[model samples]
Target: MTTISAGATDPISPGVRHVKRPTPLRESVYEALTEMIIDGTLERGRHLVEVELAGMLGVSRQPVREALQRLNNEGWVDLRPGFGAMVHVPAEDEVDQLLAARAALESESARLAARHATKDDVARLKELCKVGTAYHEAGDIDGAVRTNGELHSLITQMSGNRFLVDFAAQVDRRVRWYYTPVAPVRGAASWREHNRLVKAIEVGDEDKAAQTMREHTEHTRKAYHDLQAGSTAEPATDPDPAPRTRRRRTT
Candidate 1:
């Protein structure tokens, strides 16, 4: 069995520590802080002072301290002695690991969904795809990301495998944080892939659905690499130097 530590103690003058209970104050503070971190209201590398955070959330220092510790464990916050805490920014290798894990779990879920999904399950997944695509097209990247997650959650539910679903959910939370900070290079492609997966499931092609889902996740990793490369490369201003021209003569 795995045991996780809760770093909670009595609040000390608006410093980061831990709290002991699930009081209303703690719950409220946790929710408020979580929303800020997830929504980019709290930016990466920005220091989180316990006192300021407590003031912002309108809670006592104890609850804020506890919430910070929880967020720290969840990969949303980075705690240090002098700095208190700051938003956790995932490294490139971390992103790769998350995408790899997501691909594994989701591919299996897609296979099971293809075999066992009911008509209602198909309908719900179709609805999620529609909403996700609409959000992507509307340039609401955050909403698209959320709806995309919902689509995956629905697939996991349809798979009837509780263990896989739980693991996928945990991986997804960290993946979202990583993906959101990067530009939305593959949002359209992602939704289209979702559509294809839905179609495969609707047709009850377990093999094709699983294969497509795996490829879709692999594509995300590729897109991330492309985005990173583009950020570092010099801007291109004109067409390729070796542009092809029509042949003028025939022998």
Candidate 2:
């Protein structure tokens, strides 16, 4: 994340220009803590201590408290009166809902990309598909997942719908989190499906492209359920009720 001064003219990093200005302490704290939670730095179900977070981030406890409150509202943290805040453990139902939403969005993206994609665009998609396939074959599940996301994001951009792009961006991280458990299970076949989808797009078959995406995403949804059913440590059950924190009402 690069800082931007008043007269900055250099091209900002793609997809993160909003971080240029001096961010408020509370938002900064929230963003940092959110990343930690998403990236597994703060494991699910672990308690978050405001004092420790404040000291780590070089801020006062007030900012951490405010950030935790905001995170709670956003479903990333659960706040309890006596226990304070803890990372929200994502459950199977939540995962199903998010992936269902993703399937709807990406299937449309594939249809549109087939309608609008230039030769160069198709070539790029093929390139990413190859990279993901190579990564999966090389036993680099992390690299395969990252490149797979990049491929979907690029296809979404080809749809020429900024709203769809932004909406997909919003849920992208959560989708990644749910995908982790099933990546290896879905690895080779997933990339093969990607190849088939790209071929459909290359031929400008809108219906075929959309169907391919739908099937591909549906396969992922099934893979997730199967993985959860097979895993002993999966967070399959619903979470305990989140404790409510009292907020002082202000005029």
RMSD per model, one decimal: 12.6, 13.0
Q: How does model 1 score by TM-score? A: 0.77
lDDT of 2 at 45: 92
Model-by-model lDDT, in order? 0.76, 0.82
Clashing pairs in 1: 8-18, 8-19, 9-18
**Per-residue lDDT of 1-251 in model 2, one digit per residue for the tens?**
97989997988676865647787889999989987786567878999998898888999999999999999998999999887899998888998899899999999999999999999999999999989877877777668778988999999999999999999999988887677657777766677788889999999999999999998888788877876677422222212222212211101
TM-scores across all candidates? Answer: 0.77, 0.76
lDDT per residue for candidate 1 within 1-251, as digits (tens), equals 95556985544676656666655777788878877776678887789988898778777799888888998888888999865799887677878888998999999999999999889999998898889767766767788778877888889878889999889877776666655644256655566678889989999999999998898778677766656566522123212222212211101
lDDT, residue 191, model 1: 66
lDDT of 1 at 22: 55
